[model samples]
Target: MITEDQLTSQEAIALEEKHGAHNYHPLPVVLSRGEGVFVWDVEGKKYYDFLSAYSAVNQGHCHPAIVDAMNKQAQTLTLTSRAFHNDILGRYEAFATDYFKFDKLLPMNTGAEAVETAIKIARKWAYEKKGVKEQDAQIIVCENNFHGRTTTIISFSNDEGARKNFGPYTPGFIKIPYDDPKALERALIENKNVAGFLVEPIQGEAGVYTPSDDFMKQAKAICEKHNVLFIADEIQTGIARTGALLAVCGNCTCEGHCERQETYSRPDILILGKALSGGAYPVSAVLADDEIMNVIQPGQHGSTFGGNPVAGAVAMAALNVVKDENLAQNARKLGELFRAKLNEYIKDSTIVNLVRGRGLLNAIVINDTEDSSTAWDICVALKENGLLAKPTHGNIIRFAPPLVMNEEQLLDCVAIITKTLGDFEK
Candidate 1:
């Protein structure tokens, strides 16, 4: 193994460019280490992590409690497939189900896997329980949904770049306008074979396009009216990243009592990933009451490393840190402070149009057109000024720092961002 001290930032990026696939157009900052709300470059320059691995490090980067749990579990026991029961799987299932208020949990290894699992479960539930014809059950999805990059998940995506050459797409999905109750109700009313409506509580990959305050609750009501399942893909919004235990909880702050809140519209199917391990392990899960989850029988779906010992320990520890540190409440306070700061700058900025988001999951619309390189350039400048952020398609730059950020650090980041935007003022 080559020591990181011997590698320059340019050398490391060049190596990745030559060896790894060019699937992502990353900003030119090579992060070598992360702790709390900050990360370090190979040359030892520290920078605030504005993106937080696309909200996957909500508990902050490399938290010692989480790392320690993983190390201990790795040394003790790591893997054992479902062929035979493992010691930690049962504990993880019970702990997580209770934590999220679900009846059962099915483990997976990635966000995409968990999404695929939910789709399968929804389809199976449709056929087995809902009296839908086999292989004909349809799931309603939003037009600009960004569940994952898997072939099937991308089938319904409107992005030309992610869909262009990938063909032989999966069928059985109907698209509707996001955040509109009328559109959702119409789809369910028109499609008698619809089984579920999958949605992100807040559309993170779609430039943090948070819908109307009533969109989630309204959608759930519509689904209920049609006996359709309301599935929430919370892979990017869960685990206190969105100022609540779950975004679907609205303004709820009580540990995990989302179902008790008047605004909470509990999902028939809940998918979680990303921060489940605090970015320490590849852990994801699909949760539901027994009635929905029981559709998956033996040999229907399984991942070799899904519910292994290390994942269980890491996830449990990661969740504990979120609760112990009050990351959700912290995110709520910091997000309000961040948006207020940005709004003040945006009023006078020629480089930014507006800012919008809930909690730390926010975005600034560049004053430039969608096709311009201004957002990318601003990001490059931000990196030079001691912060790291990336743009979502076109001119929208998302700002999602780790939930561990304090008011002082948030203010510092807000200053860096506003100054960077000013540098591009027309």
Candidate 2:
């Protein structure tokens, strides 16, 4: 019976390898603790956390305000199962709907669940409102999009690893090339049953593949033209990760939520998760105006722990941290500096190709084939050099530090990254 304090990193890794499901291929280092933008391995070595748990910790790890809110609510009440209305659920709903400027919200526990919820809502809207024949409502998705791993989500995914044998995959989804508004319009014109056009404003899992600047605006316009819903999955790109409050907000620079600006391409259905709870609890939500959201009636959809009191408290606190700390503005500022510095370093570098992304959610492409291990090796070196990052889509390494990170800390991490990459230069 070894206590947590008595376990070593090797011992912990072995235990997981032996007992846990082999779903994830995590980095070799075993982190024991995290705060702000830094994490500590079991051996007490500290490193900058450049991944920020896939941007789930945008408010930063172990944020006191969010944790305190969770603690206070847990002490009083935790779960009510939606059988009876809890005191805090309404308040959270009101606050969140107001904060994000949505007419209603449907809470869930994970990003996948929220995405699933949005799909269901879209399908229902298609049948009841759009008059698409039942079971024939088709939703449009993009190629190379990483929505989630659920059965329905993977049904439309291009990732062979996730979709291979995961089916007979779910059906009624139309797939098209991403970042192409003309393709989107063609799809809508070809299919009369397009209930919604589901897209990631900036594709995060596809190695941070950012679309053109006007992609969102143009797509929204096309969806409007065809009366199809414009759904934005902001799970990984939301909560100020992309310099804006939501990636769909486009170039708006307001510190907090504001009236829908000309730069903003408001989604008909907004799917959010990750930073919603500040990494303190599992909280995800689907938001829309009443005309769209109201389609979900009693017993049609829900989760027992979806709107639990603790999640409600933690989410409100987390959103406050984003606004009170001015994280959106900070992410915008630091992200510019980070890219400029990295661009300067990669000028004559052969191992690195180019940097691409919006705000802090950026990635650097390793000058190697997708099948090559150079990107993974560079990440391992980065870990050894007191920084942590991971590769995506083979040869691309995503670098998203916590939004709470200060300028000095960001520069320090930048130095560590550049130095580590130098070790892998051809």
Candidate 3:
């Protein structure tokens, strides 16, 4: 019973409160339009978007190329479903497989779905190909991992809020401390039926926690030695959000590098989403070589809108933007600049304990406990200062802007962040 002309940000929030389930605690900003690295609120106030919709909009709010592809594809053909062929699916499949250097791709619609698909594929491969027993197959996942929110995916989460009432949880997932190769090694060795090691190259939702240097290389080697599939949940870290296309692409000893030797450790199974469609559409994918992917027969798995023509076109344009624009390099350079600026502020401030992250995916730890409202308060202050960011956990605010941001805009944002934190106690 509301008119469009009369709707304000407060009115919109009120409407959502009345009608929608209160699942999220969001900043009090009603954004209505976006382009490149910024969004406009309902009142026409502008702010730099820092979270990028959980790293889904790495190509920025709506890249012209991706939107154009989506629009063009919609006009010509949208969904033919996986039951039949589509003109764009094959071309897109070929493009994506080559881009990621994987032999095959299994498309899906969301990050969680892709993670689920990877789990199913790994379990099947373990039983049929690797000679593991049926229900005893185990997948090793890191602590503080945030894959997605499906029932099965949430089953393995260590976060109390994410897993509290969502059970009886799924089983067969073994947990190990993240960034510790020794823990993963012991888990794999002690458990003879280990089927896969599922990990995030860089933990995103866990306040952008990054792993140790040489951890990925050592873990990959262990998985290979044990004949277990190395499943990387790159839903948040992939597609150039981190420098070099993946967070697992640099050297840990290089001060600010990614530290993962790409040549030494290529994951057997890769799960991707978020930025896969440049935030233009929902597109997720699981990738593996044919030997592993072919284990599932035709009837074993499928989704109706998984590889539709529109998704195919959108994903293609998104991936192309990542490469064509060199967003990976841009993110890396900008990340260094951002961290430097933040760290400079951290030197004198008692409000922030630390700043950690790579590329554009970063987080600042508030000088408060997990139950503190400081992070939320700081985010509100940031909104007032013309920037938008959100807290992950209670005292941890994540700041992952789109890779399309420029240096001047980034510095402007840094100034806003510093000034806001400066005025927190005043």
Model 1 whole-model lDDT (C-alpha atoms): 0.91
State in Å the error of residue 374, model 1: 0.3
1-426 per-residue lDDT for model 1 (tens digits):
236467888998999999999998998877788898899988889999999888889999999999999999999999978788999999999999999999999999999999999999999999999999998999999978999989999999999889999988999999999998899988888888999999998999889999999899999999999999999999999989878999999888678865568878899999999999999999999999999998888999999999999999999999999999999899888999999999999888888888999888999999888899988988999999999999887999999999999988899998898888888887
The per-model lDDT (C-alpha) reads: 0.91, 0.93, 0.88
Evaluated at residue 125, the lDDT of candidate 1 is 93
For candidate 1, the 10 contiguous residues with the lowest summed lDDT are 1-10
TM-score: model 1 vs. ground truth: 0.98
- The residue ranges of model 1 lying beyond 4 angstroms of the native Cα positions read 1-5
What TM-score fits each model? Answer: 0.98, 0.98, 0.96
Q: Which lDDT value does model 3 have at 123?
A: 93
Over 1-426, each residue of candidate 2 has an lDDT whose tens digit, in order, gives: 235676788898999999999999999998888999889988888999999999999999999999999999999999989999999999999999999988999999999999999999999999999999999999999999999999999999999989897779888999999999999999998999889999999999999999999999999999999999999999999999989999988877675455557768989999999999988889999999999999989999999999999999999999999999989989999999999999999998999999988889999999999999999999999998999999999999999999999999999988998888888777
